[model samples]
Target: MPFPIIRLDYMQISIEKLSHAYGSVEVLNDINLTFEPGEIAVIIGPSGCGKSTLLRLMGGLEEPSKGAAYIAGQAPEGSLNPLTYIFQDFALLPWRTVAGNISLVLEDHKLSKQQSKAIIDDVLARTNLSEFHDALPHQLSGGMKQRVAIARALAVSPAFLLMDEPLSALDSQTRELLMDDLVALWSREAFSACYVTHNLAEAVRLGHKVIVLSRRPGKVREVVEISIPLNERRERAAELEEVQQQLWHMMREEALAADRELADV
Candidate 1:
């Protein structure tokens, strides 16, 4: 019998000097970052700071007008599906059942029916949606609908997950509950995630490192490492609250400036 060998310390992603623009407007400016296997990184900034655009560039959904976006040491390739995204809107098909939506991506792949079913079942269980597989998107609660979207993403088993404010739509209580579920899943699954959010508390709670972006033509302002483990999170929430307060102070000025600029235009 042969034993399988595992290499744990892999460079899952690297983005170097990545910049993007639409016509005359620059959204991202010289963004440089990296992600290691099994790490979770959160990007935080005010609205229109290009956090979502950064994720799109990272996932190869959009091209950067300059610089580079790399996944697993290579430049973003059209055929390579290393990244999966979970959208804020849930993006579930209203007409499709949970299982049907989840299996939608897999249907294109040439997999045996049993293999696909097994993967779907496993992800459904992981996301705690096994009981709701028959439910349609319209029939699910906000959190449940997001869970279905997450399950759909996980079903592909990609090496990287790009999340764009995945929990922002839910109420505070529901968001907190789903955040715990997301952390649990991350710990178990070990995929690198880049989560974008404007929520300061969420950035502190879920990130291994949180990178703050400046206002439009977004540049990296700061990157803070969160040392607490998921299980020890609540105990340190007060300490984290202080850090969150500092972050808010920094973001508040920029936010107000952004508002004023928008009002002028």
Candidate 2:
């Protein structure tokens, strides 16, 4: 069977000669890239290569010092926020239950109580959190907390997601489980995202295209495309390993150099 074709027809993201700096320190330089709708694009690089910084710029959280990232076309019709973010910290309100946390995003839109409940219910079901809808943050584990964050993001019906190592805080087993959950969600919905991570195996496992950057003052070094379908990746672990090795070869030296530089500081 062929993979289903799901596209957000007029939603293409363009990064134009993008650069960012903090006072005297430059972080990214002259970066150019494009991200199509409904595809997961993973960005991997050495420790100080500004992967998260680039994501922040793309999501409009920060202004670029010398360039711009803009969407070329319109977002999906029902999207409340055209771009939203999922951070590694989970960012859930400890005082709120899962459903309440999701409702927080919808509150500012002047929605009726019924309308808000419907949206919250939909997102919770989508993220496999329906059973935990009333659970508070402390009652859940790390992975579950991240799921709530993802659900909150989804409640907005975002056109694109800016994910900054959303799985990094979990233990290895929890991380793997969450990756599987993400794969299943993407397979069913085909939502697009720009994901940032330092883990190559994660890039290989979740990315449709992997963008590599050099050490700090990050520049686009390479963009590796994985033609394999997301649903088939688990069974094709050997093939994915080969691709991971290729990425490792490209970044190992820069990774070591970056590590040493951080140590010196």
Candidate 3:
């Protein structure tokens, strides 16, 4: 019998009393959350609720006006980097081939040519982009482009993956497929992740624990934990719809309040 392979090490992330402001305006407020290793904790809220801003803060790309984000732990068995972000834009260089785009990330690592080739090949195979390794961005479809982005991120072997509405730009069909692929990838790799999105369906489908935020000056509203395994989520879609609706109702109230704020002005 084949035992389930497990990676011993993992990263633990914590956000304590986190708050962010732009000049005089506050975007996030006292958002306290924690992501345990091997868990997919997704954050979702109404527009202007600073979902993306929180992700950036967690990645240490932006300085928080208050509180702090911490990432201090050992990575999984094969991972090397601390964290990696997968953006919605599929930020691939047009002039670079798929393999080259992946190689771009490894350039600063000072890896030998053979070492670079090995890493690129591994990620290409992981993302199912092996055949498109030499292809340019313009030649690939939207889904393929995102795959390359994911491959590039994977090549770095990040312990934590931060995604900001990564499937927002793709068509519906492509988005659905990618969602499934993402869950499968996470389940297999067991990397800690904090995915940010406004889509509740996406949240319910991908999150092991979903963190809901309130409107403007975002606050922690609720955290929903899904007990169903990843492989069972598709078959149990209807069962999960209630969780989706519950989140929608919570977010809708804030959305309406936002509309009221706009009207008051």
Best by lDDT: 2
User: What lDDT tens digits, residue by residue, belong to model 3 across residues 1-265?
Assistant: 4433343465778888899998877889998887877888989998778899999999989999999997656676656567899999999999999999999989988789999999999999998889998999999999999999999999988888999999989998999999988988977887778899888888999899999988888899999898888778989999889889988888899988876665211
TM-score of each: 0.91, 0.95, 0.93
lDDT of each: 0.84, 0.91, 0.87
- Evaluated at residue 201, the lDDT of candidate 2 is 83
Question: In what order do the candidates fall by lDDT, top score first?
Answer: 2, 3, 1
Model 2 Cα lDDT, one tens digit per residue, 1-265: 4433334455778798999998878999999988878899999999979999999999999999998997866788778888999999999999999998998889889889999999999989888889998999999999999999999999898889999999989999999999999999999989989999999989999999999999988999999999999999999999999999999999998899888785321
Q: Show pairs that collide, candidate 1.
A: none
**Tens-place lDDT digits, model 1, residues 1-265:** 3322233434467788899988888888999887766778999988888899999998888989999887554323321245889999999988889999988888988878998899889989988889997988888999999999999998887778899999999999999999889878877766678999999989988888989899988999988888888667867989889878988987998787776665211
TM match of model 2 to true structure: 0.95
1 or 2, greater by TM-score: 2
Error of 1 at 149 (Å): 0.8
Of 1 and 3, which scores higher on lDDT? 3
How many residue pairs in model 3 have overlapping backbones?
0
Quality of model 2 by C-alpha lDDT: 0.91
lDDT of 1: 0.84
Top-down TM-score ranking: 2, 3, 1
